[model samples]
Target: MNKLRQHSFLAFLCLILILPTLVFGECTCDEEEDGDRNKTEALKYKLAAIASILVASAIGVGIPILGKTIPALHPDRNIFFLIKAFAAGVILATGFIHVLPDAFDNLTSPCLKENPWGKFPFTGFVAMVAAIGTLMVDASATSYYSRSHSKNNQAQPVENGGDEEKAGEHEGHVHVHTHATHGHSHGSVDTSPTTQLLRHRVISQVLELGIIVHSVIIGISLGASESPDTIRPLVAALTFHQFFEGMGLGGCISQAKFKARGVAIMALFFSLTTPVGIAIGIGISNVYKENSPTALIVEGVFNAASAGILIYMSLVDLLAADFMNPKMQSNGRLQAGANIALLLGAGCMSLLAKWA
Candidate 1:
């Protein structure tokens, strides 16, 4: 009888422990059902944001591509130099002001452990590495292509009988420019076609890489946020962001003179990366913790690398190349105009940082 009593007591204790779980499980189910309803409501906002994103993107990218039709916007026009300069300034500001700071924030977030990340500025270090790597790639690529071009030129003899007629007529006066990067120069007119083509190819590919990296990141970040208020402004800013960036990229592509197929492929790639990123964010929104360590690390690293590439490309390839030209140096008014444009571009992009 005493053992029987003990068994009853044990069962009573188990019931007390298990009863709360059973009650809590029902509450959990109700909460989950409510959450589903909330999520469904949230979808309405997301769809609107996405639609706005597409429209803004279309406007932004279309303008630059259409600039070819505008008389003042031709690549050879003097205004084009100033426009490119302004775009370069915008890119530079983007690297330094926007992306780098965000990277620092991410890498130094409190969520990340303190031992390694907090000890030093990983943002700057990663950016520096990326910049150095870009330089190496830029130099090596130019060398490889230039060498191959030279070899091809050598193999194919010049037309008009070895081009032996009247060297003085075209000597150093053909409106020919090198645009050769990384210690390469266009010394001989005997082989300019190959050099020009190669330079354009390099510029187009590099520009795309830089722009696409930044765009996808911003797109996903915008899409994944739960706050509708935040998404609204970003929709506008990012639209303009893509437009200006598209213009910059379009300028490079236009200069590159790519084939129809190549141009379309590049344009489409630029357009899709951000949208794709947004979709990815939406799909992963359930498990994607914005404040999580893994998310911070990946985002921080990519931002740093992107910051480096844009900084280098803007300063070396865009600003310096155009600013140092005889045309710009000779015309004070044009120089002033370009400086103003630079400020405008930088200001526009800087303001957008609030949302995106």
Candidate 2:
């Protein structure tokens, strides 16, 4: 047993030391002004990617919001379960296959000093901590909202004993209104909307964190690179990636039942943040070093945190919530279909990791 533990510790330490070496190994010292000159050509193709992503995001997010118009897409239907499962799979793959791997690379890079980093796996550790933090936020926020909503229901005060019977009857139908309308369900009618909204809000905020962290890191790397050939394919890949990610996030926001203004604001934030990061990267390219110790550490820590939040949100709030629901459990065929869709979603996203 002692031998096994020691072997595990040494193996883990080796991974920590080796991984970051790969990430920072790609670094090239400062480039010339000609690097900026290459930007004009790169800009032209990137616009296409940006446009494609924006359109995809709009469509993905808007589709889920139209449950009223699309009967088959309604939350109660078996098809809706399949779609949510597929989405959850995509999110899970994003966290595990894409984001987590990238975080490991960032922290383990050769650019950073070896003494302390070589001793421990801070990348995985940070991700674990971040995931825990997100859970706390999700649970505490939901509890607070439920408590506030409970107060509101109590203050309404039943007008008469006759209305009391009506209230009881209305409560019976609350179950029907739940699962079909909100992304989440609550045991008590008073806490339903609050619980549902809190999850959506938490999802939107955390998803943004993941995308934003990756965007800035990639943007800086792109800005520092002099090779137009490398940047060309990345522009296309990242655009598609951003679009799909935005769609997943948008779908969650729509189901969250936020007001129209709130919805638009969130969608806009997701849309604009990456481009803004890219622009910032362009501005700071002179001072920015893709191989710098400080840059690697900052980017690694943030990426690890984002990966943790995204992984947890995808698995717990997105996948588990729907897959384990009574609705899914009651239907055997739907569960099978959803399982296939989940694999497809995860597989498709994992393929993208090759380029972007």
- Candidate 1 Cα errors over 4 Å, as ranges: 1-42, 67-70, 164-197
Q: Candidate 2 regions off by >4 Å?
A: 1-37, 159-162, 165-194, 223-225
RMSD of 2: 12.2
For residues 270-345, write the lDDT of model 1, one tens digit per residue: 8777877777777888788899999999999999999999898888767776777667899999889988888888
Q: What is the C-alpha lDDT of each candidate?
A: 0.75, 0.70
- How well does candidate 2 match the true structure in TM-score terms? 0.78
Best by lDDT: 1
The residue-by-residue lDDT of candidate 2 on 1-356, one tens digit each, is 99999999999999999899776545443333455567676665455445655566556666665764788777667776777777777777878887788878878997778888777999999999999998888778777766675566557665557454455335322232324344654465434544566666766676666666665666566655555677777776766566566656766775676678887787777766666666676677668777788888888888888889888888887888778877788889888998998998888888887876
Clashes of 2: 4
Lowest summed lDDT across 10 adjacent residues in model 1 is found at 167-176
